[model samples]
Target: MASMELTDGYDEECFRTIVLAGSPQELRERRIACQSILLEQLNVIPIEEWMFRVNTMHDLIAETAVLICEAQMKEAGYGPPPCTYSFIVFGSSGRQEATLWSDQDNGLIVEGEPDGEKNRYFEFFGIMLSDLLEEVGYEKCAGKVMCSQGMWRKTLSEWKEQLKEWRTQLEWEPIRYLIISSDMRHVAGSTELSALWQKAFYEGFIDNEELSVAVLRNTVRHKATLNLLGQVLTERFGDYAGGFDIKYGVYIPLVNIVRRLSLLHRIRASSTLERIEELERLHKYQHLDDIQRAFLLAMRMRVNTPFSVQNGLLISSDYIAESELKNKQLLSELRESLLLVRRLHRALQRQLRSAERWRT
Candidate 1:
């Protein structure tokens, strides 16, 4: 029988080398290798420990992948392409809150003619980068909304036109498009691209007669969660177990509402929590009281609960039964805040309907 030799501290040294000190290209390769190692070790460790290891590995890997792609472009003599391009990450990645299964949602913006070949080059780069990511275990976006997808990859001029059309039209499809576009954040590429487009789009869209209506109409798409009498229909999957799909149900709604408000006020912040804080400082929207703020905080906390797949899957959260919340006063405050948000949603729906009538 062959005896296995003990390799003391080998794993720790490997983890540090891969996640922290390596150059961009080396980090990318090492991180991918670390993921494979963690996956193989999953059966030997407890689920909770495995979750921590995998998530840490993933965070480092994602950052490394981005860096490596940038390095590749620089090495190709493109040297960051142009000063007027931006890599905008949308959806979960934009929020910096990703689960193991989350796919990519990203776009690219280059300041150039809409129909030119430069735009094609940006698309080509994005496609190649996304293909590499897929090979590293980060699956490509299923809806074809990634930067590699023509629908998302565009020149700055093209995006501005798209935004203009959506704002002017005030139709369902246009509104839906804007909703996704609104949540975008500049993750990489030309730094000023995001700010420039944001300035133009906000100036053109906010408080516009047609655009406001479009946004309000889009807000009501979450109506299925609102029961006949206007109660929030909590999901059965986690409610009985003292949990909820905070991601889809509560967090998404909060984010959507913030999206509408930010668009209305032309708030430039991307994340919901940041938008709330920024709006509070602006002092224009005083509807969010301390109680409401606390509620939003609680909801945000619930939304950030971590999860991972070990054997089958493991999801964990700060979610507790309505009766089990430790801070009763805090919970009470949050509940009130949630009601305020509900009212806001209703008011927006009414505004949209009125606008529709006026337009007709």
Candidate 2:
């Protein structure tokens, strides 16, 4: 986690400067400046280092937002937090796999029982944090999974109860929520509360074959990126016309595959690479090395996808442009990656079917 803090010029002192910025406009500019530095190093460095650098800038920006939000509340007469609570991030941020243009996938896990004062305080905090994040440039989650939502902002005990109810449902939407929560990681506030929340979540898998299979069914369903003739499938029309969806087409499919297998084995690691390593350590999968290589490519190629700079912030369609895909060598690499994803994707579908059959 320490590595998530500083990267070259972005040290602790640099973050302090951001925290101490005179106004929101200054804060946003400082963040943009940092991201510009990352943009400069993109193709120049190893994909792994570039990814690390990108996430590092995101972390600093988020932490600075947290500090500023608290100060803003105090200045507005909220005092310190009424109780112990945590600011937790979900999805890409939680997994430490966020790209430069990542959205707000976060929540609040407050201590103690759910009540009026605590709820109101965190609601205000959530709004401020989300606005601050957007001001410096992370888009709000289109799905409304952010902390500002009443569903996501809850007391620690309330979260456990919700998890329990979701676990018992064994239906599509609840299972989806369960899967989403699987990626939860504490970004700020009390680590103990976060741990307690995780303990509730990960423990739900034990003796829960029906629930696991439900998740597996969701995992196996992915967009086909290659045709039967082994040609790459590009977006046929619209703004992203003829562009390859490196995100869902390759990266997310691969992430789902790794996440499914890890959860099946009861491995609780969140990030794709970490789950692969953990699975490898336990001798869980035969094609993990190939999966790792393909996933790393997906990560790089996803970041390499076309983005436009508006207001000095990246706005991406998450598509690898048709013009860029015309390069024979790059197309060949993409085909190779998609082929692996396709193979493993079919393999997992077969596994899911087999598991269902045996259950009957």
TM-score of every prediction relative to native: 0.68, 0.95
Query: What would the TM-score be for candidate 1 when compared with the true structure?
Result: 0.68
Query: Candidate 2 — which residues are off by over 4 angstroms?
Result: 1-16
Cα lDDT of model 1 by residue, 78-135, tens digit: 5665435677777756644444455678788878676545755566578767876665
The Cα local distance difference test for each model comes to: 0.62, 0.83
Q: List ranges where model 1 is wrong by over 4 Å.
A: 1-64, 70-84, 95-101, 114-120, 135-137, 223-243, 290-306, 310-338, 357-360
Q: Single out the weakest 10-residue window by summed lDDT for candidate 2.
A: 1-10
Worst window of 10 by summed lDDT in candidate 1: 1-10
Clashing residue pairs found in predicted model 1? 85-190, 295-334
Residue-pair clashes per prediction, in order, are 2, 0
lDDT of 1 at 337: 48
| Models, CA RMSD each | 9.2, 1.9
**Tens digit of lDDT per residue, candidate 2, span 37-104?**
77887888777667766666676677677878888899989878999888888888877789888899
